[model samples]
Target: MAEPGRQEVVRRVRELLARYRDPAQVDGLGDDEPLAVLGIDSVTLITVAAELHQRWDVTIADDAVLDPEASVASLAAAAVAPGGAGDRPGGRLDVVGMGVVAPTGHGVPALWDGLLAERAHRLPMPYDAARGHRAGAVAGASAAEVVAPDRLLDLVCLAAGEALGGLDPGRRAGVTLVVGTTDTGGNALGHALAGAGDDQSALAGWVAERAAEKLGLGAAVTVGSASASGAVALGYARDLLLAGDAEEALVVGADTVSKSAFHGLAALRTLGVDGCQPFHEARRGIALSEAAAACLLRRPVPGDDAVLGRLAGYGASSFTTHMAAPESAGIELALRRALAAAALAPGDVSFVNAHGPGTKLGDVAEMRALADVFGDRVRTLPINSVKGLLWHCQGAAGVIESLACLLSLRHGTLTPTTAAEPVDPQWREFDIVTKPRELADARSAVSVSCGLGGVNTAVVWERA
Candidate 1:
């Protein structure tokens, strides 16, 4: 293959930019001009990287486009240079770092505090009693505080901003933005069309456009499922990076409860009358809640502070397991698959961030699956749930829980699974952490989540 020089890289980037720019802007574009000045946001920049990767196998770092000194020539030199960091085996595949936006806290720091303190944010449902569901809210923050009015897209944007903090904007912009939501802007739009619902496609479009704008990204895409949205987002991010499509990707998972979601859960009789009580002997059902979380991912790079944990493996599976009830088989399959992909055994996991929503069946099924896969290891590994603090944020649960898992690895502490009196009789062998415990040498953690539609996703993270 012919090596590309700085001039060649510049020529390719300019061509990609031309697709979305005004003819005048395209003509005015110069090698030294900032891409943002030419209206090249993060989404468009990723498009450019995709095009370049397809044509020249060039791997651009997230900061390349944002750097003032990163001229077209310099970018080209980096892209075409043989044995460049970007061209190395691990160059295109790094977790570099992650960020979080959850109920217990806003960023990773706050999350760590909440976990260490063993705080519980679960509370009675804020909506009308007639709605028939309680929830575990993120303490003080309200939907308005976390999101813009009737703008679910804004919540995603806010989460993305928090996740990208302390990172180079130019480098961040170079990656793709993939979001996961059970209900994208449904909470806001549902209220607007209480009687007659609006077009779902239009709502989706608005969310994507607004999120892209907020993040200064070039493209915005979303994946939806009941609870597995977060896992799906990570899985997709990994795929994109591994395909050499982009050097960096931002994966965000967010969702808010509304009348629609509340009623739907109530209709299924899965709504808890009080707060959620995962693994409790007297567990009733789940309490719907709201949450948003974002993670910054890149091809692994050494010495990146943002990299709290390296994403080692991901597994997903779907089954026709009772549509209304939990499915142990599918959950176990997903967990096993993820472990296999990571080339790890069940014993390798030191902690499990269970998708405990405080529901009787849901919690039981998840525990059963854990026992099935981990066997004797289940008795030794510490396990906890963030639901007692954040409630069940639908699509956002996985990512929010992931933030908790990452914090656990970084802080060497395990958050107690609140409201869980003891390991359910059915789950006798598991070492469910009812109180916070000191975690040492905690190098690896797993996050597991199961969605309503039989979607299950598991992700393994290793200390970086």
Candidate 2:
């Protein structure tokens, strides 16, 4: 009663299930066993689809494969059908408002002003003068001023308050907050433990809940990792929008510099002696910084500040190639995939916000990748790294860098890559915009970030 190729399809499905499932949990899975019944979560299902595509060059429809009744037999049958197509149910998503707490300035307006003026916010550490770690710190009002002392929940609450600004209460209630960070309250708790020999700061989950409560939202989620956390949060928000799970999502990426992180980077010799000077021949390394970046995503509404841009496409890749080095292949794949998804060529991108950490090897590798991928286009497009102004905010850098891209799109201007007095020889082919350039018809831009553990992400945005 089965179609001609149904058996082969079923065989492939069985193989995938066997590979993905725990041998101890499921002794053997039958063709009719539902995927959920086999204990597969959404992320795992996505991974399964990716694997299947790579193996068979067949795409699985999320709607069909995600059904509760979806089974190996059903999926195989669908895959075998010649004309069946996967259903992609999400509608277009847009970015309406962005809130930033960065070293150059706080809030969107101040940040934009600083970027346009080409001012460097890099300075000596303001919090712990004893550490003597020069950093680009947020100006005016410490985190303590906005958040209560010795409380992680209070920090989230305060950040949410500052981010919400003037949003309507009804609208705010419908918006969900998605926080991204590697260590939410670890620094505060570490200090508390050292000072009093007791663990007292609220946990990360409580902080998320408190943030949701402060924002008058129904739910909150937290994403953790290194640089990819912010992009991952944005990707998740996009999925929520497409799935009709939420009308609006507030994505926040925040992280403060900690002694552990600072010391670790210092030990690795990646900390810059001077301020961060990305893509410059004289570049030393990165300057660790502290900041938070938040952006509001919602359906397009009329008269919304002409929307700097909408997040067009996102692509990510992770590699274990190097623990402390950058991978050109991974970076290239992520950028190429992102560009392909956006249906744009390298020439279509007017500017790039590079994840230049200012390390000699890292910057060279990134430049080589760009040259390999874009070739002649590399020389035509303007490129810069905001780390020179914002320092390296770890998990927060991705979102803050994205905000900078949005600002460039909105203001029709490109901020120069500061301290890049003399461009590196490896980047000779690329047009390194040293001073602010007027962005005439520059509607789209790309932001690229690579993290430790070999995580690479590229996000494309188009003027709305």
Candidate 3:
């Protein structure tokens, strides 16, 4: 079913607000006036939201929007909020919770075990030639198949439930939720459970609302920037917390194979049939994949800093449209911004999670950006791409790989790229860790993402 339109959402919220108003205070009630001033309390707000949920089957995180000082109109807008979590311009956020839904398994434990074990979950393409355009190519496989948007919500719930299980539902509801996905990629995973084609883009709000409802969370938004959607969303989440809008946020990035996406790759003429050889001399191109992952972000508590990891900094850049080849300047722009935000020199980076799509242009452009960011130090850092194992997950790529980097930090393991293909003997600047390396001094790491439409994003994660 199509999601409720914007007007419908606003109208319904206002109607609920009016219904719950006290008769004594209804004399001159104004929608733009603070509801609390009109005698509305938290319980009243929750009651109205519950009624709406029962009548419309649209769950809501009422507490997040029902601030006593906020007007009825503001509450209505919050209910249907749209945008990244980082609404503010500057500030750093920390990660406190996380969820994972990848082919290797579900939950953080599965993600960690799979990466630490160095297992590849690539599988034969399930889409037929008519649908996928290619019959025998490889793709990333999840634990189960998602038949509809509702089922996709089920997968998101798995990852989110685990990450947020520790937080009180009331507290969780006060935090924002950001759902990230590319223009067309995540239709395959749990990301775009929304209907396909034109409806997909707008449905991000619908998906975010549903996911928030399931997680019992509040203010929600959707961000799409093609492949960098997840990473960009994470950046926004950080900003939202720094801006003091919410105490925490849940950011999820998911993607799956779709006819439109598969066909798009086929036309690009860079889709690899065998495997992704990221950064290798014999690299072909990206292999498609599906996955849904989530992270919980928040400002550090003064007395208790119980955090999974620290999202030190994030930067996003766009090179606009590039017809002939990928651009490196956009990546360099994001890298520089991320470094500055993190307050670290490029040389301090302990590890690198490269956005190696295995495409000739994509890989080289990323290499160039790294060289520019770290200069001579880029040659020695242990760099690797998870796409070789996880395949290209479209927008979800950033979150999935970022989680991998976090796991590496927790386990002191550096994941390996595919058995080092032929060396770029001339410019073998990158030390692609071909095998798992025990990282003793793993303090800070970086995750790189480049999307179609020239969106490049870099996020720095630090061990707290």
Candidate 4:
């Protein structure tokens, strides 16, 4: 078969681009203009390229699609090039690196060591709610100190730089940054503005840009979905790679405990006076913390060197449940969607990384969802949450927890949930992995995240 001419390519590309937006949004769009000028955002451009690859039986490098000077005509030409035909030649997407800043410590090793030891790093909170609340934090950074709005950028740079470490500058430019963050350093920025006046203000909210510069990357996208933000970012990264939008994608979930969170959680009475004891019969509420988690993902070339593990599947679901509570239906739907995406079943899952935050309602809902979706297997299948140990990292919860799953896949050891109170009698069927257990086959497990506003997400982790 012969390649389609430029005219045919242009027509199809235009038709596709138009589908993403109303005609008015691209009123002045030209075949020779950069797609961005026509209001086509990076995410939309990625979708367009993926569709082009799938529909036209062609493959185009991500940069070509993102090139500003290159017009629709040029992109069309590249798509129909003789070498462009066919699905991308690769195995599957894999998690290559991870970086984390949790209460346990910074970096992946610290995270693993702390988790294995089942250490709890609580912030020492002043009894005076106005002063602060919690036990102690890692590296001498109390939750109060770490949660300062200004510390968010510090966390992002620390984690992202680690994730991209040892990568030559050239490789960094080829990677796209997808940052999921709930803490945006707003209070810090506002204070700075008040001090310096408008003319002397710093760009406090340019987090993604600052992160890109710190990590030597070209661009970044910021995703926010409350506690599920990090997982949502991971979901986007998976699609970007599967669509050939980038050679690699870096996802960061970072959030600092802010004054607002403190006040709100305190008011809601969700702050556990002691450390978080998830799913305990005497469970209180969530213990909020400041943290950042990062993961680097790449599509695998056949016979590639190696990877930590493969992010086989991810799915998210939303339902109009109360903002402060979770509904089992949405949680189950998200889990089933992820399993189906991986072509696996509940029986195939080795274990579940639950979103158990210890809240009476949250834990109960998640447990019921697991029992309903996995059936009697819930009685024997291992399920646990890092929240018992890590505190509630909020937006970073998803990313850090998912990283735990990847670690288990690599080490063949299923980490245990910290020993909390006994299981709530109403939900005794679920097998909470309360003690460190070695997995006979840690090949596949699902990591879950329950967020405010009914946002729920799940990602499938598999052996590389």
Candidate 5:
């Protein structure tokens, strides 16, 4: 089913808003007026959204529901609500190719080996002392070795090159590019401050532009929702394809170690000095890593060997709960929505690639969310976190871990989490795999990401 026209959407939104406001207030409400200023609460907005979803059968993101500036017209424009959660804006997008450059290794083969071997490649922290003694720096690569002024951009090009290599040149026409990063060229700005380069090009916009130019792709849209940036970018690209706005999408996620980023994490006390120990009783916090990962997505082609897997479903949600701490309700909503988007039941999910930043509160919140959504099925669900092995790659972590899901679909094995023993008693019902486990007949996986500003995202992938 197609989404309603802009006019219809606007009319429906305005009609709903009128029910909550006084007739005078409704009459005075301008299209640009802030809903909050007019005494509209979040619950009222959510109620309106629920009604709209029931009416239009389209998926409306929680971010829009909680947005402070949400007005009737803007909400209508953003919702485009076509089919409900059970309906995908577009059909499944095939992941034709993937590439990764991480602290564990570069390229898919090396990455798979390192992950299956459960290796934690840590290096002495080179940035801020407050970030701890060890960090996950990409092996054998420095800022000077890359052609781009920013190492982050260089990583993007490198990973994109690999993913694009498998794509036929004839199929590259009008390919949209989406880059995700929290510190988009922030390190470049640091160098510009030292008078080493043009300061203007060091801005976030230039990072996306330069990366798209370097990769011979279209003007890039960058997503920066902290750790959820990659997943959000993937979801955004999927929506574009579904909406017929683009024929193809090259989604890239990259982040490099920076003093500012380190200090921020340090301020939050989320740096793991010893190492990331997800779901463990003695878990400290995240071991920051620099990584770049890319995936090429397009409409599925019959008998295409290059097709790695299908992006079966994706969902995103944001809460006004807490800045750094995660809320289980938001996480569960995203997960349930993604499953609905995929048209899959909780029992169908083979395993989960969790965010698991190894923080005290963050890990517990995720577990509770998983338990909430999966219910008794949590006891058998093989949930694992790669952060203990590859460390948290920040903005790039989502796609990097997503690639792990594809690899699992391809290899029929579930990678283990490192040092996950002495499990947190709170989640004893959950199976946190610490050793490599064969997938057997499993054919699907879920990757969940939660970030600062109460951002949450989930993507479900099925073997293609």
Candidate 6:
């Protein structure tokens, strides 16, 4: 095979650019001028590189893709060059450390043990109208923990401490904190409403600021995308690292079960009476729980042995069709985009950590998306949901579930969907895991999360 003419390559590059930028702007660009001159952002540059690989079977180096000096001429030359791989849009982030506090237990090890052993602390909802509906509550945490600001902060600080323990104390100053929560300042508001605390702004980002202050980290940001908050925060932190805005990012997802959250889900008739049983025929609904999880992410350093897994790529989407129910198309789009960004095919995935919240509609929509994306592979592809084990931690669900993926990568075992019996026949196409399964040398896995308001997120992970 021969390289395309320089003129043709330039034309193709410009054509791809037109999809993300104004056609007029792309058309007016000079071949040899840097793409940055046209105000092309780093993300768009990576997207263009991925498109180039998809169209021409060639890949540019990630450095070249992000280079401010690189232009259409340079990109075309790289495309025509031989023997390079991986110029996916989001690149990858090394998950050097992780921590978690859930109903199962504290820290990653305990959480892993509990998940595999099917151990959870279930109790009745404290509220009167809850009608003895049980949830996977954190064992030592009180039912009113959500209304206690210090308690919630303790959860964040504890998880962050464990995640940051391996890093040198001097390096903490360079780390940025990105926290995800559905109820940011809801605790403070709850206290205030009860006349137990002074009036203060209950902003969504307040907890992030508090956590950063406590952890002695750099700047902080918060993401509150319902149940998908954690994955979104991880994605944002990855973007910051990819764009050279942060040396390291500490992503924390912490949420406690609160009265309002419980009543809201109850009002929606999405609360489980017994416990979470994702993908089961007798599944009721979500069993809301409390959890906090933290992950330390940074650019891969050569010869670094601390890495547990690699965040190869992530993608998110929001469908405006429903406020509560999810749309399969949006979920499918996020899944497809994640694989594309990671330069992975559906068949390359070994297993999946799903967002199965146990509700019939939610599970049905997610299964539909999976079947569409993976096709016949769904029949054999090992898939499992942690909701049955950890329950739904709302904003914290994404990170806790993603941590399950990292564990799977490190241990080469897929954790089971605890007590998920009588599997839903409608989803018989999917190989839902009920017992621990060996990974058999597979390296890549995906974690999919869907939240209220039709928000969906997917992340690809690789064993380090």
Q: Which candidate leads in TM-score?
A: 5
Worst 10 residues of 3 by lDDT: 130-139
Given candidate 1, what's the lDDT at residue 398? 82
lDDT of 2 by residue, 54-97 (tens): 45645455565667777777676656232233322234467766
Candidate 3 structure, TM-score to reference: 0.73
lDDT tens readout by residue for model 6, 1-464: 14555567677778889987899988888888888887887667766665554456455555667677999887776653332333345688999889888888788898889888988876666663337776566657666663465656777888899999868888999999999888756556777878987744344567788778878999989898998998899889989999999999999988876667788888888887767889999888887888899999999998998888999989776653568888776687678768877988899998999898888888888988899888889989899998888889888888998899889888888899975788998876669999988886869989998888878899999999
Candidate 6: stretches off by over 4 Å: 1-87, 144-146, 199-203
lDDT by residue (tens digit), candidate 5, 21-127: 88678768887788888889886776676566545644455677778888766676666444543454346999977988887777888889989987645566666
| Model 5 misplaced regions, further than 4 Å | 1-40, 43-89, 129-131, 142-149, 199-202
TM-score of each: 0.74, 0.76, 0.73, 0.76, 0.83, 0.80
Residue 271 local lDDT, model 6:
87
Q: Report the Cα lDDT for residue 381, model 3.
A: 85
In candidate 4, stretches whose alpha carbon ends up further than 4 angstroms from where it belongs are 1-91, 126-132, 142-149, 193-205
For residue 127, give model 2's deviation from the true position in Å: 9.1
For model 3, how does the per-residue alpha-carbon lDDT over 288-322 read when each residue is reduced to its tens digit? 76677899887877766567788988877655436
Clashing pairs in 4: 122-136, 123-134, 123-135, 123-136, 124-135, 124-136, 125-134
lDDT of 4 by residue, 1-464 (tens): 24456677777777877787776655457777777676676546555664554356344455666676667777776664433332222235777778987877878998888888987566555333544457435545854565454477788888888887788888898888888877645546555556833321113246777778877897688888888999999999888988888889999888876656666777877777766788889988877777888999998867766588888788676643378878776687677657756767789999999998999888888888788778888999898888888888887889999999988878888888885658777756668888889996768999999788888888888888
**Per-residue alpha-carbon lDDT of model 1 for 1-464, expressed as tens digits?**
25536666677677776788886686686766666676566545544654565356455654664455555555565564434543332222345545555556556677778766766454445565455545545556654443233445655766778777766768656768888877745555654566544534325446655677666776677887778887898888888887778777888887766556777787888877756677888878777766678887777665655555678888776643367676776677678657766767788898999988888678878887888788777888788887765667887888878878877787788888877885578765678888888887888889998888678889988776
lDDT for each of the candidates? Answer: 0.70, 0.71, 0.70, 0.76, 0.80, 0.81
Clash list (residue pairs), candidate 2: none
